[model samples]
Target chain A: MARSDDEYDYLFKVVLIGDAGVGKSNLLSRFTRNEFSLESKSTIGVEFATRSIQCEGKIIKAQIWDTAGQERYRAITSAYYRGAVGALLVYDITKKDSFDNVQRWLKELKDHADANIVIMLVGNKSDLQHLKAVTTDDASAFAESNGLSFIETSALDNSNVEEAFRSILSEIYRLGSKKALEKGSTSNFAPNATQTIVINPPADEGKTEKAKCC
Target chain B: MTDDKTLFGVSDGLLPGRVVRLGKPVDWASILKASQDRERREKEKRDSSSSISDLKSSQTSIPSIKPKSKKANTVIEESSSPTDGETETGKQRTAARENSSSSPSATSSEKLKQLLAEPTLNTEAVRKLAWAGLESEMRSPVWKVLLGYVPTNLARRNDTLRRKRREYQEAVNQHYDPYLDTKEQSVVTNSSTYNRIGNEEDVTFRQISVDIPRTCPGQALFHIPEVQQALKRILYVWATRHPASGYVQGMNDLVTPFLFVFLSEYASVKDDLSLLKATDLSVFDNADEALSNAEADSYWCLTALLNDIQDYYTFSQPGIQRRVHFLRELVARVDGNLCTHLEDEGLDFLQFAFRWMNCLLMRELPFHLIVRVWDTYLAETDGFATFHVYVCAALLVTFSEELQDMDFQDLVMFLQNLPTESWTNREIDVILSQAYMWRTIFGAAPSHLQQAFQASY
Candidate 1:
């Protein structure tokens, strides 16, 4: 489906890394296909899904790569870090072990991903409030200290799933725009500037163009 | 009860160890007549109960009398006649009970060993009866032969292992030579050149590297460098060879059972797998020799398995989608009411069955039982790819009552994490038997399903 509707201004590779059973695959499915699985098995190597979004008037096609969360999976997942412009560093809110491994995941990103890759600290499974082990305040503070954006999502309940992707993509787009302005035409912004689709609507059709973004 | 106790006491000791028959010798005609009468009575009772309960939960009772309603309807029609099919299931259960009473390991090993020795044995027949489940000790060799890791010819088996091990080492040696370098400049230079070939190899190598350590992190045997590198080499080589599919995430999981089973063969202590953890060099005493052989055996077996299901891992993953589609249709045909309930509740087959089909139900069952399931799959005609659809249908049918009762979220969650860790060989047998029944009924690609498949495409 993503392949069929491929008219996009920008293609950003966003990697999802977290602990096993942290629901990275479900999150990706919920966002891309509008589907989620409660019986989500541990990711094997790497699985990718593409979804296009309108961010800052540019068609941004987000190619999200979900990686296995186990320590050894880093071997293969680290390779996926190449060409990634964004990283969704996910941890289960109900799982303290998953939350504790966020720092290690951050280290993995730093080691393998691009230096300027936008990182998001996502405390997923927010719907499981009763079983919540990692508090929102604590996760937000941790994200703040680590210089990363933060969000809480419930893929099962379809809560914050869309906003999480939008936030990350918008952030990546803003950074790309800023970098482009500084360097003028020769901006070394991403893997490709040609891939980014910037639609310039006529001034009179502004309202319609804005409505078309979602 | 006192007479039974006296009879038990007369048989050597109070507990009959391995050699004892509980039934007395009866005339052949009487034995046949007795089973027939019991089967007839059982069928009548089952039919009467089903007719009474059919109105309330038509789908729920279908599995109980599934054999009778094989050709009934596309919507799980009620049985037309109670005596439509033979009560073979009752007989099979009795046979299975008898088999369990005997020495499981000794009898299974003997049957399998004999079958292996026969040059012209019907493997399909062997796989259908008793062989679906095997003894622990018999698995290593049986799986190796089943997966085509070893040649069926006895004379060629040793030579095959020798050549494959040598080839595996050569590949590992050549590929990992850069990692062995001490100097920084050479490593960088080599990496850049490696990148020049295409980033595919580098990505493959890195993916394998990360996944190997993570494959089975809790298991100490996997932590050892020897085991880790072996997994790495096998995965990397497979990815390199199959550029179209490359390395998907789940392929790593498929490789584990083979490696564990192969390594088990070389481990000195047969019963206790934990003893292998005591050694640092390798799990087995022969160290590198056994490790390399295991690596080679695992690599080939994994390759064979991927060859059968490679479409699932390809970039587009149409294989999984097709299988999932087939499962939906299969479920509709086999348990129409449950299928209708799922449709009403907005439950999709891909939500849970994708993993079921992709992993060949490996994720659902534990390691010991996974092999047993595979034993049946490997024996069937395109069992992994074709027969698996029925297995998925059978699994869904098992949860029909609960699925109908639950709402969307609960159903999705429940399907995602069916508590299967405690599932033993018996549970697998039930699922497999039900799957086999479905296969006989709807194995042929029916016209309705073909249209559904085409419409989706």
Candidate 2:
């Protein structure tokens, strides 16, 4: 009773986290549903939505979880960290405190999430240039030092929102393909192996495997 | 009459005389406390000139049956009599009622007591008082009674409190024994219980561990070690007992208002949190007892509230999904232009409204407004679940003009940071009134939402 559109070659669980009021939910909404609100309430625990994206002839389903940014919510939100192959550590560019807390968030990811979790340091609310507190260069430098990919996005204007998702998913895919390659040629074993990789994504797989069904 | 500007004005001072300055981050709890003191003093001054017999006659003749009910609690009288001067809790009850009869501001409190004291307890009357906003001192008792946490019978209420507090302590002690054992042994002796492996306990326990410190981390009272542990125990027990919904993230935020309000019943922390030294709390002779009572009250009220909207926390959150869908449709019918505007910008109700529905808009509104709103919510039959849709719609409609002008990025920014801290009881009244208007137009939740709600549960 599931829709055919739900079928996918790979499923990657991604999580969005940062300080409270940094627009994590809005970013998830813009990416998954292409919608924004002027009166969005703060996230409570964890909410997830799935969107399947086309990646080099393969349908990669992104099961993105948007989490509460408050400190108390970390308890409930941390439970969602397991099995996440990708994380978007979003911070409001206007709030220096949010950007400063990025390191703390990184430590959280290291402690609870997958060790090789594809983390993208997202400076959200990029449209609020007039109120920018964390400069692009500073966040970029921090991301480089921490070995995280960096991008600026405005979930409001839909700026870089798609690219943010595409970039992370593609990065996750790239790493996954590489791992598959190193495992040697095993076409029969690829799909099952890749399916498990959705949670703990493998490091190599250049060839994109297309499922025979659907 | 206090000028609206002075009472709820946008003052530039660090501390205003009697009103909460709009747009400034004032110590909200202090303002509530200050207002209470002012009302009491005013009532005392007015009552001092009246003959003692006249005061007694007014107390007996008033609609409230509180005096008769109080006589049932001999235990309460014995415990409270010694501390009468310091607490004035008993005298305050009489003053609270008499003040209500004399002043327009205490009208809700007077009506609330009358409704709560009836043989069966008039739920309809309580709901109306909730809309009107409860008196500061009366909210705790009113909420407990409304939520069915305490017995309706006056004689049974004290005994019920005593029993429930004991039950809560037992639950906490049992769950915490393993952790305490490991602490004393300095070894992983209780691994079976302590190091849970992928069971329901481990999952929810880990959640409570991380969440307890974060719940209202901004507040001084919540920062205390004792408060944190109590919150942890309360949430953990709630999650364990309710296995179906275990511990969810936002539930932490929901427990705080109850804890804050209930704690204020015993302690006299200063309004200015910065001034509260750690040593000040030691002054309370029975802080542990007071805290346990607060914990029990918070747990029960939270359970009552969650029960009304349990579907929202269930797996896949079908309740929220349905509510979001309904909100979107409701907006379309109520404000087609604004709804279409958001649609053109590719905005949906779920992006913002989901939190509104999940937490009953607690995240959007400050504690002051939230407490006032909750008074009415506890009164209404379906205030938290169904009626909230209208409130959300009314809230959104207030910003239609700005929303109509904003693009996607602007919409997202504006929504995530709405300027609601400045909102007073007046604004909330307007929102509630407007919500009632929408209810009149649309009736109860439309057919689709009903089906979605039914299907989820």
Off by over 4 Å in 2: A1-214, B1-102, B110-120, B178-199, B269-285, B444-457
Tell me the TM-score of each prediction against the true structure: 0.56, 0.57
**Residue-by-residue lDDT tens digits, candidate 1, B55-98:** 31232212122221212321222232113343343333233333
The TM-score measured for candidate 2 stands at: 0.57
lDDT of each: 0.63, 0.65
Candidate 2, residue B345: lDDT: 66
Report candidate 1's fraction of native contacts. Answer: 0.03
Clashes of each: 17, 21
